[model samples]
Target: MKLTFPIVIAGLLAVFSSCAKIEHKKIDDPAYLRVFNNLNYTVSIENKDEEQPFLAMLIDPETDTSGMPVSAAIVGDFLDQRDGYAPPYPSHVGSSNSFKNPEYPGKESVLVGPVLNGFDLSSWAQIPSGKHRVMFMFRPVNNTPFFQLEERLKKKVLIDTVLQLDSHEVYTLHILQKNFRTKKNGMVLRQEVFHKMPLSDSMIYVNFYNMSADGFADADISLKKRIPQSGLLMFGVKDVMNVWFSLFTNDELRNPVPGYRFRYMTSLRQNNTSNVVQPYYSFPLFAANGTDGIRTTAWQRISLMVPGMNPENNPYNDQAPAEVLGNYAVISCYGNGTKPGFERDILTVPNMIVNIHSGTNNPQSFATVNTIEIVNGRAYLTTIQRKYPTPIY
Candidate 1:
């Protein structure tokens, strides 16, 4: 009887040990990718269609016997969305609140990479390193998810190309409008390398990019005319402008702050196609003190200045009166400032003061790469987060 019991227990252990493995498998030889749909057709007077900008990205589609793709994996849906901070939560106090709408939810839009306020790589999607066929097709902006959407809705391909991804490399694919007049759009793939910098608690890394369609020769004339007279002067014959990071306390503009400004940071005539990744420029993370553990937040107003504009003058100050062409404000990282009233009031206004600040708590918790992208005459900020501790098992 004892021998029989031992044999039965051994058999039960074997059965328990051999249970099928259920886990989310990790990718092999993985490469990281993030997609941003910066394509703007609103400036197009004739060809602007509301549905043309919304795109669905397909990778390695499965083909049928007829050599046409029967099914595909959707990597990105609603690619018209931009990366940035999320909007404030809507108040549920009233039945018919101003923020309540069936068509638009206040949720922030994002791709397959870092989310708004994310500090780590947990959200970035991983794909096998090799050559893969990629396609971006126009999709309707509806409740239908990309995978469930009918094939008829994805027939129109805006971008079709093969991407060669290297092992352990990171890439950002940008869909930018090539020409507003011809309604042409294209994609620019940038291999991102986070260059190591001297460690400092007070400095933040940033780079500038001019992705506006106004750079193109065939850009819409109406768009160019929309630029304020001060901004046009800064554009000058070369369409070049300098970016200034001015420290402000209360309401005073403090330029001449060392290492806070860049001369001719970007040229408006150059598009993302011709873009080479600019070197990271370090700036003081806090305006009051140049060191950490002092203040949790610091505000700075970014101004777009003409190359010839005297650096000594403070554009933000009415008394000093510098030739500051325009300035940018962070309304929402998700591009929510594009709404009708907000767009006209905040985005189009030249003298409006838009102040961007560091985190309100634990400012040194994670590092960030702030990319100031200029589209048309306005500026948008996209922050790429990095260097936060991950869970160790």
Candidate 2:
């Protein structure tokens, strides 16, 4: 009897050890990828039936013996239709609580990555390093998940291409409109430099991309009236915009720091024909240490000025010429928080102001790189959080 009991115990131990070996193993030397749906469209009198911009990304779809897609890996499911970056502040008072509620979760709420700690890599997906067959399908802007949706609804494939990705590299795929007039769309794969830039303590790095649709004419009649030239010379060259920045005291619109002139930024090429990885432009993060004697907060406004405008004077002042006033494509500034408010109000709940020192042992302060994506005449802003010891929430 004692011998039989010892043999049974030995068999049980072996079976349990085998079960532990069935755990999920991490992928070896994976590539990271993130997708952004930047495609913009408008419904007007000319074309009343315009397709919405919602999408579902499928990578290496699995098929049955009959060649039907039985199942596949879904990288991005119902990527919410966003014209620009997600808002920085909570759109409404209680909207921030929705992300915590299990019953009502948000899109891209749970991201698949190598690790969720140490950086804001929640938007990235970890895939095998090699050639990947990617497909972006049109999806309805409804509450249903991608897999739960009807098979017929997922038939429309907008972008189907094979991408060769290298190990340990990061890439951002953008779905953009080829031309606003033609309503054609295409994708641009941008390799992101994830490494931190060599910058001073009070500086942030930024770069610009001119992804504005081709043949996009400014429809602002008031701007045309101010310029007032045959063929509207200003409208003829609307694709080009000069970037400008100004520092001001808290809510002090009437007065700005004296002698702070706009610098000449590199002219971005039209239609995203410029280099995929543009050179970074460094800007000082003005300290709010009350040295200026106005308040403990300083605000910086970035304006996109049209070509031909003189950079010698302040464009916001009334004393400036009408042509200068009308030439601005868009102007943006930092806002309250990362969670955008309900309704996504651009004016009130604008771009987030991330504290570069948030996740570190250093004192908390606002310092972050503002990623400004200009689409058509509007500018969408999103701040990149600096890496620190602690993970970014």
Candidate 3:
């Protein structure tokens, strides 16, 4: 009886092997991408392909103007919460947790949401890889998408472009909030190849953000160290990257120059205007015990903040970002305010603090960088301006 049972099991194994040999297994290895909404407002995006386009919102802003679709960050926060990853980002207002972004992790499965809200911090969207004609449009907080892209872009702000992607590689199309200059030309959405930050403590990279509301065309931006020129990212914001620093520095000068200091100056000139350009601000590039908390190299970011749509924001919030060194940053306007005595040995110096307020009216501080650290990455959040610079031409 045991021998007979063994023979039957062997025969069953042979049948399974035969079936396995005949069956064909297929594998798909497409490219990958992720969208990050860094603009201070809600945004809807879509892949404009002829055959099968990728759309973020189920409701079309063009067709349904008021169907305010949630943003990538909002969606990401919700998904993470549902997957047992969070209590949910603060903005989640639905009641279902069965949601999944069909474009990633798996095919297009529906998402069940729950009601909650969050700061929408670090929310990112993963998408199928491919070449795409991406259309990025702005939707107000209520999700009321009210304009045909072609018509809306004429009077409003949007970005349209084509991009190629590869398998397993993650890409980011970060949106920055700049002014809408429809009469100028087609402005592509603020995009960047997001490299995962290196884990090393001494790692350094520059994220130059331009949230200036100068009401001018895209300008030629550059960074200079008291020398000759040139220059992350956001919609109206742009970053001049590719700068690196040693995890550590030598106390003594490496070259023979008698004196020693590394300082920087930034220049911005409107692309549509005359060649008359000016230096924004200048500051020391490094500080003692810098990487720990200094501004120049430690912060890893240099932002240009100019007041935009929010008129009240001008000069006050727009003047300088409230940061680690606000006491120094907000006052150093080359003319106005005193440079208080502080232990410079402990803090890093900022390079881009500037008087973006009307140079004509605030000439004393105009074309001058503020001494305070202007919060560069964010769009909103500032104290009411108790006073404004004199209006200039």
Candidate 4:
């Protein structure tokens, strides 16, 4: 049967022996379907029809015990995981450089939940490898102290668009919200890893993910150096988008050279803010892995603490930097000049993978891919600048 937890999960006591050292690898098995959630709402998957159906029981309203919305049940599940040292726990653990999640005795554990952040990846939930139909359900509950506005709670379902799985490939079934306001939700897939690639080379590949609700359906990713200007990689909100590019940096230059740029625009400016004509947005990061193999400052791991990136309260204090670094870069589209992340937020946002060396745009925000890029050679990169009390020239 398909694995589905109830309001109170039975506990998958599969604790990691060492949280500090995680070497991600997929165990050899049949094709798997890991349900990846990137939404603020708690959810349940029903109407799970397939050649061999995966059965999961729902909280029957008639015999419900806790008397809470199914959505709330999921939220409750997330709350069960409390630790100052682990990932996915609440972002407030009175922390220092060590044990951000506040490692308590017997606190080294994780759980299954319907609601998840873009970075909160789950283990691959096994499924028969073939075409299948499944429906996602999310209930808008605004009572929590999270970022849900009065009108933020809107019910949604990501229709199955004929999901096909292969035994050799593990896929992330995720939901990327369009704008926080409109109901333009989409299901996008990211191949977490490819076993085909050699171990040494896989660590160097970089992939970019646009989770910002900026309303642009697509984005252009480019890496340029003075000698050979590499063409930009195209990414959209749909499909399984993964174009791997490795950054071969010299040992001296530990961090990837900064010449990375992510650009996109809002389809409708009014949706983002009540007052704003500038719908265009862009983010340019200064860190980089030098083009040649001789540069001293190579790309090393960096962390980013983004505010307002996740709707609830700001998450800089308690949450730890993402492990997806070296492979992922998350761009936050939600930010205002008056907001906390206005000035010093970028300092918290660094390029580890998703949140590493994060940069924001008054017009929009940008980050690196799953991997960082070192521009080949210094070339004149065109940019737009606004004149005081005048149009951007």
Candidate 5:
């Protein structure tokens, strides 16, 4: 099937608004249907403000011809490392002398989940002009005789023509999966090990496309909300996002001591906010790893803190810990002076939730929260801001 239409610019006066009209035209073509391996993903629709209208579609691979969606319930957040120390290295003592000292490192622990819930699509379609999409994929656990996983790996999801708007609508025609699929199981094992490593919990990618006959254009992501001066928010699938750190031991174990440094960095920006806030912290801890690797089995720990009901009243002390909040944390990353992670990489978690301690003065008590999710290690977040229609540039 093929989709065709003309995107009219409306008069030479040329103005762009959140609620601009969309026109689409469909032409008859060959009736052959194209199919591929199981396609799984989440699609979101937003109007002009670029927020709201967030929707999730889990294509059941077994019967969903469109593609099957991996059950998000199985994904959980769990911490595997806490209060752990780093490997030991040789240090210079007196002139030309080398010495190794016993050091300790410690980290708190927490677990993410097997289930990711709390999503709403009603608001997205109501926005003036906001749309977005989130997708995820997971290979079945080994030795488990689950037919669903087997079926998901065999189906292909296609994006031909979306029926949301009837005019000037360009359908993204492609079948894609976020997770890696290999015939060999060894690669999967490598991925498992890498998953247990201390890498950044975020991924960034760029795509170039032809939106019109004029030429090719590049699309970038940025955070759309104003950084909150107070209150707390959650990021990540509370159950599955995990953090890990490893330690190695050498021959300096005489007295047996452990110590290390700690540092924390956090950032926040609100929708349409002109500025962002970044803060950093430092601390110390103790860690110890036995000479035997047997004693060094994998461990789970909480890397962040989750906020409480009265988080606002204690704005200064209301911050959620890393473990309870999971591995998700706002960073200083930006695009052209704009926060990028929220719009493209981390939109699945609620974007921004206003905390009204004494109660809200604006009747629009409707809080604006962005959402972010992960698929194959990539983060997708979205933000929507409302503003007066500005003249077309």
Candidate 6:
């Protein structure tokens, strides 16, 4: 019996060897840095997954849009005319700033600097009559080490190109609304950003559907920007109401109180240089299932952009002057705790349709109309404007 026990134990050990827990070693590297030039004209920074970190240096290229060179800061240091930041980094010079965001943990950091300074203006001196160039630098701070700091840092620099003035003064945007009706009688309205702007500097406008009539209220559209990538515009609407609004901006995320229940965002890509001519589309980049609070009912319809439309390859394809890309995005919430359906993928479409059912309390429906337009450093967001066709008794 003793001999048999020993054999049994040996066999068991061998069997579990592969199942043993594995631990990965931590990576160590001195604090590295990179720069993301919002060559697209908008300020945005992207990480490995292409996911945007909370750290962003929001700036409007139009603020210093000129063929002249100038000196500026990077993040921790300031520079007038140099290749890059000093020390550790070679061929770079500028000022740098660092900070963390309490809202997002461990991953909050930023480094901002000049892109094209007065020293770099030598190239633009005798060029075409209406040529302009603007540049910027970005360096991110992190808790852990990232890969390829040197290469990433250099690519982080952004450069933007613009014409002298009166570039593609297009001023037409589309507005659409989405309404949801759930079993609990829940209602929600969504706004979308449709059409593209050729100019890096422009304003956006959004109007409430029921402000003038009864049951009308207002919400402010929050403007947030991701340097170099893109920006987002969002607003919320509840119950049944009609509201009217008119707003404008030369800076996207800089707009103040554009509309009631609407928030606006812009991408750094707006300031990038590209040979392609088309407006980019705006669709929900992120959405929640609503399992925690204000659960939305199944079969509810919400505003969403229709998919398959190439926001970067469509509008201004054949136009003379370069073109700007534009698109729309919508978000909605429901209550009374209802089962979520396939709405999780609604943001992927260029146009979104969501339906909500709460069961037996209050059945509600809502919708939104959105548009995008650009003129030099000015942008506008305006909806088609709507009033309830019938009473909501």
Q: Per the 3 Å backbone cut-off, how many clashing residue pairs does candidate 6 have?
A: 150
- Arranged by lDDT, best first: 2, 1, 4, 3, 6, 5
Error of 6 at 307 (Å): 9.8
lDDT per residue as tens, model 6, 21-131: 555333221111222111111324421323222222212222324432233222221111111111111112111333332111012223211112111111111111223
Winner on lDDT (2 vs 6): 2
Which numbered prediction scores highest in lDDT against the true structure? 2
Candidate that scores best on TM-score: 2
Candidate 2 structure quality by residue, lDDT tens digits, 1-393: 356988999999999997764343466877767666775444455556656677777788775575435567544666544534543222222344332211101234332344322235444556778988887777777767667788777677788788888886767677777776667877888776634345454565566776767765555443222221111223323566677755554454445554333655567556654426777676555533345321124555555556667655535344323243235442435345222222121222133344433453233444445566655544555555444445355
Off by over 4 Å in 1: 1-23, 43-45, 48-51, 64-68, 83-119, 195-201, 214-238, 249-251, 254-269, 290-292, 311-367, 386-393
Each prediction's TM-score against the native? 0.64, 0.70, 0.31, 0.33, 0.19, 0.21
Worst 10 residues of 6 by lDDT: 118-127
Q: Which stretches of candidate 3 lie over 4 Å from their true place?
A: 1-124, 137-140, 143-162, 176-200, 211-262, 265-393
Per-residue lDDT tens digits of candidate 5, residues 1-393?
443333344532255664465442322221111111112112233223221111122222222455554353211111111111111111111212211111100010111111112212111111111122223223222323223346655233222122222221112111233222221101000000111223221211111110110100011112111123101122222222222111112222122224311111222211111112112121111134442311221111112222231211323232343322332422121221233332322212221221122222221212222222222212332221222122332
* Shift of residue 190 alpha carbon in model 3, Å: 6.5
The candidate 2 region of ten consecutive residues with least summed lDDT is 97-106
lDDT of candidates 1 onward, in order: 0.49, 0.53, 0.26, 0.27, 0.21, 0.23
**Best first by TM-score, ranked:** 2, 1, 4, 3, 6, 5
Which sections of candidate 5 miss by over 4 Å? 1-330, 333-369, 387-393
Estimate the overall C-alpha local distance difference test score of candidate 6. Answer: 0.23
Query: Which structure is stronger by TM-score: 1 or 4?
Result: 1
Q: What TM-score does candidate 1 get on C-alpha atoms?
A: 0.64
